[model samples]
Target: MGSSWLPEDAEGKTLALVLGCGAAVLLLLVVVVVVWTRRRRRKPFDISLEDINNDPISVKSAPTSRTPSPKLPKRLSCPDAFQFPKQSLLVRSMTVDRVPDFTLPPERVQPRANGEKGANTTPLQYQQSLIGSLQPDLYSHSSSFSEEEDNYLPMSTYGRLWYSIVYDAAVEQLNVTLIKVKDLPGRGSHRFPRDPYVKIFLLPDDRTCRTSKVRKRTLSPIFNENFVFQVSEDDIKNRVLRFSVYDVDKRKVRHSLGHVIVPLRDVDLGHVDTYWSDLEPMTQALSSLGEIQMSLCYNPQTEKIKIGVMKARNLKHADFDQDTRFYLRVQLFYGRKIHRTKRTGSRGASVEMDMNESLSFSVAGKQMDSCRLEAALMMTAQRNGGMLTHDVEYGRVVMGPFMYARGEELIHWQEMQAQPRVPITRWHALTSNVSHD
Candidate 1:
């Protein structure tokens, strides 16, 4: 019984001894750890310049703006805050200056990695070098051109107007027929386009007397129009018939293209009553505003002239006071005037009147061979007192001392002075754009 008991007891005692040894070892380790922790807590770790220099593994420290430590404590590898010394001659001798993929402008320095420049130069030293390399080519090139020459001079000469003149001796009227204006400039030059029209006036009167219908978007325009001017055959030489060409663009801007001035004296009335004139620059002429048919009758007994202004047709329409109601004003070459004769809402207007007033009757008291009968079509707003102002210029027309629609010599003065007859009627051409002084 004793032997059997002893085997179990021995095993138990052996297990107890192993457990006691492990407990003793654990207690000893805790005591050693507590003691070491207390000693480390009492003295803080520190680093110093002397320790750094003395160490075989020299570490580059950051700026000394931080407080310097007393002495360096042993570290696991090296503190990240310090720059470690090169371990081998390979790192010390080798240098790298990497090239960039893109080129920089000459004035600007190429920036690099590690914030280092062409050399191992300090950052401030590299910045100073950049100022010395800066150049001034940009400002130098910009200062060489003129501001005004870049404008205005590029636009130059264009082609001209050709026109002719005629005189009707039976009725004694000076007539200008704009046969056609040809050979004007062309459009291939990438130039500002010309919306060309011709305007004419008989001067010492700069007043614009008439304008041809504007021919749009062409460099060359053709207009066949007839214009008449009342002049004594002797007084014709003193007159200059002026023609002006213009570029009209109602959406953008308008400007004069050129002008041609032809003197009546320059034209030979005997064999050559009609000829072409060259168009030039800077000056121009006048027109009657529209077309009308009229009859003239002179009673030799009363010494009075009756002008039957039958009606106007193909009239240029105008809007004054933003509406199209119009009345008429008639005048003679000697400044004799007839006012407020008729009013009409249609573009075709009718104005008939007889003159009982004073008449200088050209070639005084003689048969009126040719006289300018001017009809100024006017407008008056209902809101205004119908008073005509100098600013109002709508349309104008001029008729002759001729038969209404007969196209024959019809000045009543000539018929009455020669042989009294019944009144004859004829259609008269009218021109427009009469400017008021």
Candidate 2:
């Protein structure tokens, strides 16, 4: 038997295999063409030497032919070069271009008769002209301000009190009737309304004074209260009546709103005529508070200063409470600051207190000249069911070589300085202007 090169049935199989190989070869050729075309069209990243030289932030290097040697951007080494520019940028950003409303426009120079502009005016000359033009208006405004100032009265004159004084010769009594008060300045919206009352004092005899009933929550208070003063017909001419308006607080502290003084001699008291008077400012005087006695002794060898609170007399009873206790506070001041502070034991409140307490402070001899001594009388009273105690300053006295010490206080300091070892005792009238810590 003779065999052929391939089986006769393998013809179809060989033809199918050749067709599949041709399709695969065609697909591979198409992919290679597409890839080669894209590679030719795409651009290569190129950075030129001119661009690199123009950019200050770029790193400087020798020219390279092959694909600009990859270099990172360099940081600015000299930061100071940009400092002023940054500040200028900030200043420019903050600067406002708008002109203020108060500024005036620039004035143009007047033309000359020769058909030429006049010499340009200097800034100074233009300013002077502007000032001259504004002089009359400024003068008028200043005059109006002065008028307002003249009309402006202090807070003490914020209200007016109406009252009538009558002298009854038969009874030898001066009767004063307080009609009402008007136009009292309001304290504030947040604070409580003022509890206003009137106090009548016979001048030179303030020991005994009469007070009216308090009217609450009213700026204009109606106090139709009558107060009588026992005086002789001959003595009435020399007497002066003082009406003091006060506001009382919950703590029983009296704040003087205003006061008025009327001389009986000036008023025809025979007739019952009502008069209105504007209240005046209350004067703060040392003699009004009371008096205190203190002794000062300085030892140069030991560099110590001693203060002896001998006694206090004529202590003003501000609260008039029987259970009030009084104490003395001694403060040593150096260079306008309190260097040492000491207080005596509490004593029963009285017109005359016998303390006999001595307080000592260590101070250099050279510092004695600049040092000052302050003695304040304080009073404490039990309030709020005796659970809360309130301390109020009765009065104070200051002694030093400084300007704060005047009259007897200065003399006492000089005496103490002159006699170092010997104790210098002096009486000083207390003042109400006590410095509150």
Candidate 3:
């Protein structure tokens, strides 16, 4: 009876269409389920905020679909990030608006009896923030900086020192005194009552390592100690004084307190000078070429400045030559070939040399304004490395053209034209300043 009521040829066609639509819908549902399942299994996330979405290798490609996919939770990319997170270790001049006092994370295990180290367990963030911010600024901006803050004062427990260098023209020597080191900070890792001491050196001349006597059990030790370098006024300008402080451990290991570098050029040799220098860590490994000692003299009547290549000493040994040998080439500020020393051998394989020759340049009939003297120390020893088989640089040094000018208004030659004929002999340090003044 129902079939009769439905009554028509179109009824079969309608049922067929309905069945087709149902099959299509079912196929679509299966496809969606497969896609969603794969997506969930592919990237399940259980991570902290800092590392969340920090996928360096996972690059997102442009979606191929015309229809929008269902929206998942939006990832929290901090608004401050300009591009992808760089994870860069080096950045320039960060201005910290505030410094964070990062406390050590709660103990992973509370009992020291468990033999777990809780000291270094402090999260890296504590070492990465605040105090660490000042490190690059302190150590990097100026390698030649001698300021108290540039010395990393709060970064370590090693104390700071005040020192002075006086050049006695009469004696022809540099009287360097480690006037005092104050607030000689102690380290917790060491035993109490520290045996602290100080070591000094004139680099490229480590024939001597002048160290102060151990001041036992004193945090505030006063070492009014004096060390001497048999250097001329001209020669001292080219050297650097390296100062190091250490705690002599019971096992005889020198636990470093800190370090300080004083360029003798920075010292006012004209008078007895005192400077408060901050202590820094010995991070740079320095190699010595050698030390060059020379002197300068001005003859008014002859209108000539005479420079002598006195000697060089405490040279770094050349593996090529059983005997270290070198020579000197003197040049004026204007690139004039003034003089050259004789090709001589070291004295019986000694590192010292005695060059008795003098280099003379005529300043007569010319403006001697801002005259400078440069002496280059050259060596002829074969190299140990194959970088070069033959001769290479042993050392180089420079003295000032403007160093002794009387007046800026007058011609440099005119000022020296009528000056008293003083046979100026000063121990001048030689360095690699070959450029003309």
The estimated TM-scores of all candidates read 0.29, 0.36, 0.33
Candidate 3, after superposition: displacement of residue 4 in Å? 99
TM-score of candidate 3 against the unseen true structure = 0.33
State residue 198's C-alpha deviation in candidate 2, in Å. Answer: 29
- Count clashes in each candidate, considering only residues at least 3 apart in sequence or on different chains: 27, 0, 16
Model 3 per-residue lDDT tens digits across residues 240-347: 787877787777756667778777777777665467666765433232454555555567678777666566665544333554456676666644444333333333
Output the better candidate (1/3) by lDDT. 3
Q: In model 1, where is the ten-residue run with the lowest total lDDT?
A: 403-412
> What is the TM-score (0 to 1) of candidate 1?
0.29
Whole-model Cα lDDT of every candidate shown, in order: 0.54, 0.75, 0.59
Please list the Cα RMSD from the true structure of every candidate, rounded to 1 decimal place.
Answer: 29.7, 24.6, 27.4
Indicate the residue-level lDDT of 157 in model 3.
49
Query: TM-score winner among the candidates?
Result: 2
